[model samples]
Target: MTTVGNRSITLEDFYQILFKDNAIEISPAAQKRVSDCFAFLLDFAKEKLIYGINTGFGPMAQYRIDEHEQAQLQYNLIRSHCAGQGKPIDTVYVKALMVARLNTFLRGKSGVHPDVVALLTAFINRDIFPVIFEHGSVGASGDLVQLAHLALGLIGEGKMWHEGRQVPASEVLAAHNLTPLSVHLREGLALMNGTSVMTGIGVVNLIHSRNLLNWSLVSSSLLSEIVESYDDHYSAELNEAKHHPGQQQVAAQMRAILQDSDLVRKRHEHLYDKKVTADVLEDKVQEFYSIRCVPQILGPVYDTIASATTVVMHEINSVSDNPIIDKDKGSVYHGGNFHGDYVSLEMDKLKIAITKLSMLAERQLNFLLNNKLNNKLPPFVNLGRLGFNLGMQGAQFVATSTVAENQTFSFPMYVHSIPNNNDNQDIVSMGTNSAQITSKVIENTYQVLAVQLLTTIQAVDYLGFEDRLSSVSREVYQQLRALVPVFTEDGIMTEKILKIKEFIQAEHVQLPASVVGQPAAVAATELVAS
Candidate 1:
């Protein structure tokens, strides 16, 4: 079981909990911290006026609540903001949201009752996810609307997903012999006012984006090999001259992926060692930019994803809540620590990087499909009668259309913030919206990559060079060939595209640590089965 609260959660820790199904346990030290913070808030609020405890929230902070109605105020904040409108967020993202929320409370600063973290832990371990919506967070005063839905679940007032079915929160909590959280000393305010919703979704997006980059690298390597391209483009000598770590690392990975391949030709042997006999050489001197400039095209994408991972991980460990209760200092500090601008900007940048990666994948797919460009494979890589049968032609439309959608979705959501909440949040983050859109772009790229991979295997079959490929390329080709055999005549490829997409997403490709310039876990990871 993964332990929360005792220490900050790492990306690896998140991967274990979300993908490996490791249950969570609250550290005893964390439990004590929560109890202490709550005890301090109780004593401190007796004769003093705290923001949410004694006064109103947002613009209504001017109104003071009666002593008897303090508890009701917390409940009112949660239920009133359960105004999220849209389809429910996927359960995977909701699970991430729960973990992010639980971690914040575990920091012992939210002044929340111990029962809040305990209940969240129980829900996470039992696979019980609150029905959070896709919309309803401007992300300045935190993911208020989205997290209010989370708070509603904790209080056992709304719907939740359990055992693959949406059910009432009360029923699920009861079935597991678990009780819902009871408000104590600002529990509702603490739960509803945080950036966990955006942070959680951003974390998931980072993981998938990293996976997509690795697959794109793999696809590029295979494409280069299939066409007997020169090895110098990915060589250390060529990439090192550029002086970017991502570029150098990508070149190293390409070299590793195409190791021991008979298909890639040595530059000197083809040109320097031989005398020119024919005035016009039949073999093109250089390949298209899509095939030759893989490292240059994808280098920035690698750096962007790495940078995003840092920002999102920091956000995960941060306490993005209002009125931090410092038990040691015996003070409750109020400020806007809940702002999601950090995550919002990172998600926007990440989607832009991914959009470029999809464009690269599309260009490579086009090179393979158009025989005139490749001069190696038949039109559409069709092995059957050229005009009568369509091989991967229909699939190209899917890739092209998906890439176009990704381009449209790449528009930055960070800059699209609208003023809400009585102008109190004049400059909002729109962080949740950014993360959700990034997730879509990542998913769309996977569809594009799937079509490209299918087309690639078909092209390799046409060349009959299955045995001459690098070990890694050979393994991938064999696996994809097994999924859908090389089709000669026209056939329905919709299911084949999906099968390959899911297969590659679930499959983990671990490049050498020395080559990737990072640990195996960071360089590439398996997508958790969704």
Candidate 2:
């Protein structure tokens, strides 16, 4: 179980709530703080013209609202802003948005009534998710359109995802014996004025990116074994001399994965006096850059993922709304804390890193498929009659095409701002678009990595030395083989490829605890601080 708003929330905590069926509770202290803040706001708004309270919002802020219509003002804000137009976002992301927004309110700085927080908590705990759309946010002024849809759901005015189906919010709330939220004072503005959309998507993206990174390392190790590559490239002395912690960690992980493999050649075995076979003598002294530079290439990726995780985690735990009420000082400060620049920049960096990782995996897949580069493996790793089978020839093209798609999405969304909101939000973050692209990139990467895994297994089988595989590699190979059969006959492969992608995405395979540790968990902490 997890307690929302009582303390800082981590990515892991959010994942637990979403995937682990963990229940959530709002603490008494948080409720009291929220009540106190709302009381202060009510008293403060009676005399002074407060933004989103007695006064209008955005470009119309100069106009004052009649006191009798304050509640209607809040209601109109939610109704007018329900402008999202794309397909409904996945329920999990909407839930994440709710949790993130709830956390912000729990900070007791948004002047939201405690009932608002309670409704959000109930939504999460009951698995009732709002029907938020994908294309409504510019990531400035707090994802207003998308969040307005969320606010609409809270008021039993929009659609919701209930029991795996879309239903009217009024019907769902009625069935659950819950009452629609009554917006009071600044509650509507507080609900819509934040970065929950980007933060929620970023949290999910960060987790998927981490899983991809781990699987990339595993795939690299398996490729090295398949090619009978030399172990000198991952030597501890070489990585230690570079003094890069990420590089060293990659080297360590590679060493751990390739530890007991007989296929990886030791340096001493290449000595002139060893009396090796002629084929052994002809082996390249070094490998292609994709195989030789795993540490250097993927080291920065690891660090970037760690850094992005830190930024996203901090965003999840922060109070990112405007007009922060400092009850202690008895003052309200309106600022642009809702700007999603932090998450936008980090997501851009993460997408580029993931793209590079996919590029490397594609190259490795080529090395395993092409006869000229794959040593003794047959062309396309085909095992059928020489002229009859195409094998994985077409699959490699798909992997390359996916990699190209990833490159296209890798462009930074944060740098392309356009004016909206009557130019009040002249410079926007486009964080929701950035994070959505990052999510697609991650999906594409999973497919690319799936291709590599499938090719590696085929190559290993062609070599007929499965007995020599490292223990972990053999275990993973067996697990995959259980799902996908060897493609000796050359038929349609779309289903097979998708199954592997799903398997990876579902995290059915995991590295042993020894290969990943506390170092990986905290790698970005220091980087984030700097």
Candidate 3:
């Protein structure tokens, strides 16, 4: 089924809307819930004692104020928090934040009126996103500052980007037959304090990063086999002895992919056989830890994506609003469930996994480039020109730089909490920085793997006409070859590498990662049994 925007927002739907160019919908039930919250707040405003109504917020939640000065309170809350510094986040991420914020309000517990929810929902379905900055949220009080800007925009009070045009939210809404929304009771706080900002970013980034891990494996293993490393390194017996389930899966997959290769033959003792060279048994003796230790590493990547996904999925589906309704008890429970610690922990782990994958990709490229280690290939696969080939020096440089950046991104942002709001938020999650960093890590990872692909195709050319690769590897080479021709003269490797990256992204890279990470990989037993 095509993913539409609603509470049922899965990672696939997220991919569809965020990356795959799919549209979304605002369900009727969700609209009703949103409308109900807004209506309740409007009637409840008669009691100005409501915290965040005609009263000061946060550390001053107990302070009472005159109803006449109430409108300025909401505006003041947004303007003061607009202190977010640093470059703006990607526009797509900003849209995700809007969608998530709108969805949470749909759960009907926030007491926001239906009209306000309908407006936010319309913004999502119609692709209208508020301008949100990157560095404002401390992530403890739930992406406070950035989301305040979003809330302000929802009420037609802040600025937004609409249909490729930037305009004041009040003007845009007015132009579209709308008006600034009424914020009564806890409506402003309901819109502002939640994990929507970070959770939306976390899911989109983690899923994409997870997909890149798959691509990194595909690129790395292609280079590993091209270098003619022993298939024995992927033996099930070795992995089974270690008994790591992930490693077992990786070894098995490698064995399966390399199954029917003519290249995997036993050495013949005949003198005539000596004339034809196969992969050297000694130099190919032990595959490097980068290739052999893949499952052990990428297993963690898989785990990170899964773990983060679970937390974010729940965050999106449920009512993250404070003072959650309890019709059964006829009361509300105000709590800190809105705190984003869960998302922070998962994002930090994701950052590490992404960094590891980028480094592995760069390491794979280095192996392919080092002629001394790559069996008999020229340094940097000089591509038969020796003196004339520009080769993959530039691709290698980019891969190195990208991986370095990923390492820098992996530093845990969650640990650095700053006090805010009169010591009320003495501790924080920094989930905002964590999620944003996770996004950057994924981008760096893409560039790193792109370079590895360029170098791997070069290594494949250098290993030509040898004892052939397995049918599967041969087929994969065929796909890659469609984009990257043999690097015989090295005209422009950059475009080729980029095109291959696009190809890899177009298809979900899951199966290929499994193929390379075959922890249960065993030797070719078919011909021996035959």
Cα lDDT of model 2 by residue, 489-511, tens digit: 97888988988888888733455
Worst ten-residue run, lDDT, model 1? 521-530
State every prediction's TM-score relative to the real structure: 0.96, 0.95, 0.84
Deviating ranges (above 4 Å) for candidate 1: 507-530
The residue-by-residue lDDT of candidate 3 on 116-218, one tens digit each, is: 6667756766666778888888777778888888877877766788777678888778777766677655557777878888988986776576567556545
Output the worst ten-in-a-row residue range by lDDT, candidate 2. Answer: 518-527
Candidate 2 CA-lDDT value: 0.85
Model 1: what TM-score?
0.96
Q: What residue pairs clash in candidate 1, if any at all? A: none
Best by TM-score: 1
Q: Kindly indicate the candidate among 1 and 2 with the higher TM-score.
A: 1
Predict model 3's lDDT versus the native: 0.69
Give residue 199's error in model 1 in angstroms. Answer: 0.9
Q: How accurate locally, in lDDT, is each candidate?
A: 0.87, 0.85, 0.69
